[model samples]
Target chain A: MTDNEQRMARAGDYVLGLMSEEERDRAEHDMERDAAFRDAVLTAAQHFHKLDLTTAPEPVPDQLWQKVSERIASLPQMQAAETAPASPSKPRVAANARPKRFGLHSLGGRGGFAIAASLAAACAIGYFGALATVTNPQPVVVVVLDTPANTPGAIFEAFADDSVRIVPLEEFTVPAGQTMQVWTLYDKAVGPVSLGTIGAKATEVRLQGPHLPLPKPEQLYEITLEPSPGSPTGKPTGPILVKGFARQPARS
Target chain B: MDATSDDDLCTALLVRVARGDRASLGELFAREAGRLIAVARRILRRSDLAEEAVQDAFVAVWQRASTYDGARGSARAWLTTIVRNRALNMLRDGARLDYVDDDMLEHFGERSADAEAAYAALPDREALKQCLGQLDASRRRSILLAYVVGFTHGEIAADLKAPVGTVKAWIRRGMIALQECLS
Candidate 1:
């Protein structure tokens, strides 16, 4: 065979699955880099698929269709599936088991000033200068807490200063005499650590300085409904109201 | 053979699927599922693997329906390519054909007159049949074995009782000839 014939034959082999795994990988890489080779491969694939025209159509088992439908229905978000290609999407591990909805809202006007003053005072008295300047130097990791159903609930911003700021995006009602407590879990395998308590009517709570040495990504930030003082066990004793993972801003 | 109404119908269903219409996906499955499973069965040579391939292909169809370009190829051809690739991946994963009886493989190769009629009825495929028929018997069967059953050159050589190099030459020449005839 001529050189052109040999090249086309290799392309044909790739389309027909005659190449070994390594050969196939090299050929696929070539197809991606070389337009001519890609065209040849697509052409070969189009031509070879004609063979199926003559093959008799077989019956699909009834149960197989059910399995496929059930699987598609179970996807967490069908919105992503609409535009996704044939190849699987990037697999991601949520710090928690659920997907989160994030909405960033700034604290503004008079309420913002009072809260900032109280936060600065809280930082000066409780944390000392060691933790105060920590956030000023490093990146702040923010966590947006949402329900499993993808409703926006709250936001947790972790500063390098070892302080975590929690803002409730949605209203929460604690039972009579009960308080809402915030917690953080760097690892799901380990249990949560209490950050501080917040009033039922409070719109935001900035934990002055928690025991976290540094704010890390994928740390779970959650709010649980607890007794007035807090969980006696030093762990979350009530049901979790909202939760999410800390994330760094996507780099440009 | 060029852009028939059936092709248009498949493309329409795919567009609906891209818009998140579950009913359209069901319609596409209803129309094409049997043939897709049959193609998968030929390559995988086992019912269980073929079923898995078909399920995966439909899931892909759901995920990739938006990527379908009608100007590029027929919708059936596009969907068939996805099924074939899925089945071939299973075959390449060291899924042997040993579980299937010999007659099953022969059944895949067998074509009744009605099947030939059905092939001729498909848009553009009749041209394919005419081109394929023009090849030598050995060349035609070698190409068919590779395309339909996902056979390697060595497997085709073993099946045809010919040397591997000779089988390779036939398929190469056969493909070149088909490309010329179809064009």
Candidate 2:
């Protein structure tokens, strides 16, 4: 087949879930960087979904919608009224604007977002050895935050003192004039409370809040861009960049 | 409502969802969740994983509704695309579809009489049925197996008792033919 036909066919394979990891990664990267490739993938997706006709409907679990609504509540606020394709640009936060704090209203019912434990997700924890207490070693929990496409974004570690250490593993940068604020949601009923402002240039930082309780299992950590200094509203008002669930470390 | 009206309702609900309307989301969920779950379950094979995929897709819809342009496609198709991708990703990340038992693969690919009847009943799916019918049995089976079962080229080859290269060629050519025929 010719190159165009080959590319279209490859797009078909991608939508069909037939590509290997390496091939998939290359195609995904193209989808990210190449608009034409993105269109090809979209077309392939549009066509491939028609095959759903072959399968019969299975009974849906009762609580599935509840679970989904909760997850949506936990996500970062919608970027804008118009949905924009994810571009190479970093998330931007408006300056001098009162950042909107996450509220529980948008979430349906009382069942807020569930950060179910994904302990099996391979995550590397880098603890500052000097800070490790020899007499009372505290369990350090690490969560590798990923993009919707499953690409690793950052490593978030919560300590015994409720303090969180944010480390950049892959490309994550807050544009100049904007600050990246971290937040956590402890309860499904409660909204995400701000942790603190992180430096744009800083690769790693330990965030400590005296009033906040220690980190617990199933707590979600997310990063959102906001105006300088921090969100005036004490909540995230910008797009969520990366997020992950903190699961209890596997017992030794 | 007719299918076109149903599509319009979905689009309107998506607009409300984009505006942070929770009730509209609930309405949309009530309407489409079952169908979306069925689609995901078929690809992921595990009910729990399928639910997870469908859940993620709805959450995505809530967040990404503003991105939907009516000029491009129907809202139902957009929703299905999200759930389908989510389900396929789960399978890939978990390596759930990497290995398939030969006996199970045989059963999975077999088209039941009931399934044929069901396919014929859906008028909206007639074009797809006709397009799929035009391919030879192997190519059709390869396309259906890959789409419905989330099978990789190697897996399909193993099930078809063919070489991997030959299977890949068949899938690629088959897809091209389908695209051309559909267009």
Candidate 3:
């Protein structure tokens, strides 16, 4: 078969759910890189999707929505514009921007407060080391922050005492009069609080953050570009260079 | 509402969902969950498993809503793709299926029937229906069983009483021809 025909056939296999797990993964990866392949897959998916719509709607269990709501109550939506890559070389981010608010308020629920309290108990055990009493030695949560381009930008290890060890994964070129400011949203009510600010040159620096509730899983951490020292306003004012949700390290 | 308007509403709701609007997500769920469950049930066969698939798909939708591009496809199609993939993954996990048993054989028969029923039910106006109808019966059945019910090549071979290699080729050629016709 011709290359275009082969691509179309593979796209058909992917849309039909016929590919093996490994093949599916590769096709998805290819879709990210190849616009033609992605278009083919999308077209095929749209074409076959009519079959899915034809199925008669079943009676959903009354509690199903409740269950879904509870599960997503603490989850935050990734902002399309904020996650958009600054450069044109990266994959295009969605152009639509409806809700423009930033920080914890964007999360739209108080359920995260309950999760934070529970996470503190887990943090007390200190999975990384036996010495739990060693004055904030272990990180409560490790966040691998990624650029809007989805490349690793930085790694943040937040401690119980709120001191975060920042490791820059990429050499972010902070403009002549600009600095990279770190921020986190621990609660919707409090909004995003500034963690610290780094200079023009990126480096590994530990910042002592304000004493707050213990860091929890899925907490938002981000770095934004602001004028000289920092944002004239306390909140992140400029474009987000990188951002990610905190995840707890696996228990050893 | 007609399908196009419903699709437009879904797209609008999804845009709101991408912005962290939980209420819109709920609205989308209330609107689409029943239909999604039905679609998933075809592949999963069990009501509870189908519900699980829909649940997972919603959570994924919440997380990845920002990635949804309208230029790529309709919101309904995107949602369908997510649920279908989830259900397919659950089936491929193989933990739920008891192999080679009489019960499984019965399920296989039911699955094949469901696949054909889906194709037979397709609207005559749909180009997909015309293209799929034109394929050889074995090829068409093989593609349908795989797409509609998440059947693997080996399962299709078993269902059609044909060799797995021949079934795979039939599907590959069938898909090429189908795409060519549809295009």
Candidate 4:
């Protein structure tokens, strides 16, 4: 563009998260490797590097720490169940084993906190409905909604809540052309329900459970790559990026 | 305990974190949180807001421990980058940018023992610290408060009892000058 416009960039916008939804797209549209930009970032990063954390401060609130710990503790167990062995057709090493040992049943979600989100449980056992088949229940299909990295994003407590979280594996890089979309499958339903797109890091999904109050346990969940805005087909047309079963501990 | 040594301490803590050791992570948090909060408080110019920035930063470090690459920079450098980016994201949203919570525990701790070791061999390490010392007393103070503390230009202006525009100029100039010195 103009020489003047280049200068402002030379100064680098002090603004963090330099690209917004649109800006990011535009920047990537015809992105090129520029040494000047690289130098500027390096320079800025060095200065940023100097900020001291010698005095990290007092511990954060116990509540926040508690919330984080709970989230972390539940995550490994939930991740394991979703990662449990799938059918022999897709036989791979079982990655869902406990933290360092073995124990299928857990008390808190894993052991017994009535695992609330078992979507991955269903997905992991894909087509193994018989294994998950409970005598009192109608047939249920579970889907472990995960990223390409196999990190569990959400366990659909119910399709109605439409609730979901994009669990990250490092900061994911979404290429310029495609966006991530979440979907769900029910036996009678036409196809996966769109949960919407998310950022590279964790993002909260707004559920539109207009029809259902929340996704029932054992429902199938999946994420797929679609066009910039999203898929016009209204169903996942691209390769299914992540799919999983839902297993939630029964409410006692 | 100075910035150089601080970076060293961060690296040691990160090594422990990568091993999935929660206790060491907590220890690191206990040591670095306050300074992080203090800088954040200055940058946001609101104590509560700054504290949130620090908390989010630490939580992320715990979750993404595997991604930290020591080859790129020190642990302190990597972490400061995380904290700064998160804080800036919050600012960009133009939210209240003020900390708010009941009985929010502030982080506290001292310069790391590792930092002391790193500090010993630092040649021209003081270049950055010394450059910061050279600014006009007021300009230098404002820049240091903002640079080290993460205070925004506006917050620095208020703290130094100067105009926002003036604070902005000092930061811009200070950073530019600081850049020159570092290079």
> Which candidate has the top score in TM-score?
3
| Candidate ordering by DockQ (highest first) | 3, 2, 1, 4
Residue lDDT tens for model 4, A64-137: 55654555556664366557774232111123221111122222222221121132122211001101111111
The number of the candidate with the highest DockQ is 3
Q: What DockQ, between 0 and 1, does each candidate earn?
A: 0.16, 0.20, 0.25, 0.10
Candidate 2 local lDDT, A1-252, one digit each (tens): 787677779877877777765676566545544556566666666655555644555676777778876776665554352266543222232231211112322232222111100110111000010011111123346777776567777887765333566787766567778887888887768788777777676467666533344456677888888888788787788888788888655521
Q: For model 2, name the residue pairs that clash.
A: A70-A113, A83-B66
Model 3: residue B122 alpha-carbon error in angstroms: 1.1
Candidate 1 chain A, run of 10 with poorest lDDT: A126-135
TM-score of 2: 0.53
* lDDT, candidate 3, B57-89, per-residue tens: 898777656545555567788788778877887
Best by lDDT: 3
Candidate 2 stretches with Cα past 4 Å from truth are A28-44, A53-58, A76-252, B95-125
lDDT of 4: 0.48
- lDDT scores of the candidates, listed in order: 0.64, 0.62, 0.74, 0.48
lDDT of 2 by residue, B64-175 (tens): 5544444455567777767776776776674564564444355554523223443444456456677777888788777766777667677678777899898888888988
TM-score between predicted and true chain B, model 4: 0.59
